[model samples]
Target: MKNARPLPSYLVQRYHGWKATTHAENKAWYRRLAEEGQRPRAMIISCCDSRIHVTSIFGADEGEFFIHRNIAGLVPPYAPDGDHHGTSAALEYAVTVLKVANLLVVGHSNCGGIRGCHDMCAGLAPQLEEKTSFIGRWMDLLRPSYERQAGIADETERLRAMEKEAVLVSIENLMTFPFVQAAVESESLTLHGLWNDIGEGVVECYDPDSARFLPV
Candidate 1:
């Protein structure tokens, strides 16, 4: 018996439509990308949520932005570990090799990873064990934020605060890398924080002047 779920009919149909669209543009653009190489002007770090597509959200085309997707869009502080550093490796490639001029950390509302962190911290989920899953380990990166907000009594406010705080934490971690820090100090690279409200179809940007998130 097959345990795999069948593909949705709509998805199958969409694939054919995507093929036709891509085929028309692939010859010209794909070859150019291969020959000229990717010179994307920005690097975006976003969540792996299917609903939060960075390319579609930003109306970006292929080879336009170097994107790295991870659980909760979290960026851990720089640490030289032998284990795979998926997000950090992508950052190094984009900044050091591709030399992208901008880096944007896009955080979205109602992120499952963020929700998981909140749930786990509230004792609504199981404790981490030796066999802790990948998500559990990834959410560990947000422990500091969770700890800081532990005293909050309101669940809704806590989640919202955690979501935004997580983005700030990632930006802080980005600076831990020597290359990223040097670029920022030299004004060669700029960092941006964006919040996407998936339900409302609204985008909020971090306003440094107001020190708050304002709709954009």
Candidate 2:
């Protein structure tokens, strides 16, 4: 990060203002969180996109929700054999140690990762077709979704469907963890899925029984 530029002055000034106002007002709450440690009620795995604001959407407070973000908010199928698994590690800690009651996978429309997967698989992104491309390798996680949506005729609908598919796939992948499965069986934990329409500023929650997303 040595080459990283300094943060803009405006952002720093805003932070100072928040410190004097928001932080000052909630000093005791912050202290309590630091002292007693966080016991979040849910773990939200979401996209790394700037448009997807997890805490803002849910109106979550500090230490209220354990959040992990990745490209397209994907959860790769349970592979305990991998050498480096950042998302899996975070999930393990959240489920087993944190004992969060709810695990949520939130995906959004217009995801670059999902689009990249569509392009790379369709031979649109020649650069991403390279085996060594990290983004390409990461985007492979969503390939199953692409295959599933192969019947969709409209390009826009396909993209939207893929976005939702990412959420559904993540929900399935969460079960691949032994602890997660055990928790779900014991009724100690529940899984939820959400898809966001960034332009519309609308969110839809996935209903397992209905197999559809209802407005939230």
lDDT of every predicted structure (CA atoms) = 0.88, 0.92
Q: For residues 1-216, could you state the per-residue lDDT of candidate 1 as single tens digits?
A: 588898999999999888788856587888898999999999999999899988887799889999999988988989877888999899999989999999999898888888898887777767642255778878988988988988888988888888888898999999999999999999989999888889998888888899898898
Q: Assess candidate 2 and give its lDDT.
A: 0.92
Superposed by TM-score, candidate 1 places the C-alpha of residue 160 at a distance from the truth, in angstroms, of 0.9
Clashing pairs in 1: none
Using alpha carbons, what is the TM-score of model 2? 0.95
Off by over 4 Å in 2: 1-6
Could you tell me the TM-score of candidate 1? 0.89
Q: Which is the leading candidate under lDDT?
A: 2
Flag clash pairs in model 2: none
Q: What is the lDDT for 63 in model 2?
A: 95
